[model samples]
Target: MAAPRSVEPADLSPLAWRLLRVAADYEQRTVEREIDDILQAHISMLENGSRALSPSRCNTLFALYSAELTEEQIRAIAENF
Candidate 1:
């Protein structure tokens, strides 16, 4: 199996989590199924100290989540340290 994504507790802010939750809700998706993937990817990026979210990926995620967030908001979450 591939290595698990590393994550730091502090790297994820409540606001970001809330946004993610809202996104999941908008899609009528369970957190376990959809939102978790994005959260895990973010956690991995945070732990690795890598800024690796591409616009295409963000768009795909937003579409999956049915999130109404703007590109700036998504970028902010991904760029947050």
Candidate 2:
């Protein structure tokens, strides 16, 4: 099989963007801290400690955002990550 394509913040769908915004808001509220930049926070999380999003983190993020994402989109996320 060919190598998976990279998933950039720009490549994300509007639903993906909404998921990031919600996740950022959820973290800020639960942690009692503000995320000055939601998009940056998401990028950091996706790139956490590596050039790519770790599988575990990707699964976790997918689960967290699954409520707002379609299965096809989640599958796309899996493929990208």
Candidate 3:
């Protein structure tokens, strides 16, 4: 196996660029929600121990953000959880 090389945004197809942006945005939103949830007592930091979102929740958030992404992309993003 080899290390992946970094590429400029100009190197990506329009769709790929869009997907990348969406994924990054999703991550930011999820992290923000987790922080808010912890402060509001909606989730317990001591018990849960981790701030990661579940796969189903990721799917829901992705859906809320965009309908353009394929199912494979959605699943791939959710699997990060």
Worst 10 residues of 2 by lDDT: 28-37
Model 2 Cα lDDT, one tens digit per residue, 1-81: 212234434345445534553643454243223322234445444444323444554444444455454555545654454
Clashes of 3: 0
Measured over all alpha carbons after superposition, the RMSD of each candidate to the real structure, in angstroms, is 10.8, 9.4, 13.0
Candidate 1: give the clashing pairs. none
Best by lDDT: 1
Q: Each candidate's lDDT (Cα)?
A: 0.45, 0.44, 0.37
lDDT of 1 by residue, 15-78 (tens): 5544654644542234325544455646345334464445454445445533455555444564
lDDT of 3: 0.37
Tell me how far candidate 1 lies from the true structure as C-alpha RMSD in angstroms: 10.8
Better of 1 and 3 by lDDT: 1
Error of 2 at 36 (Å): 19
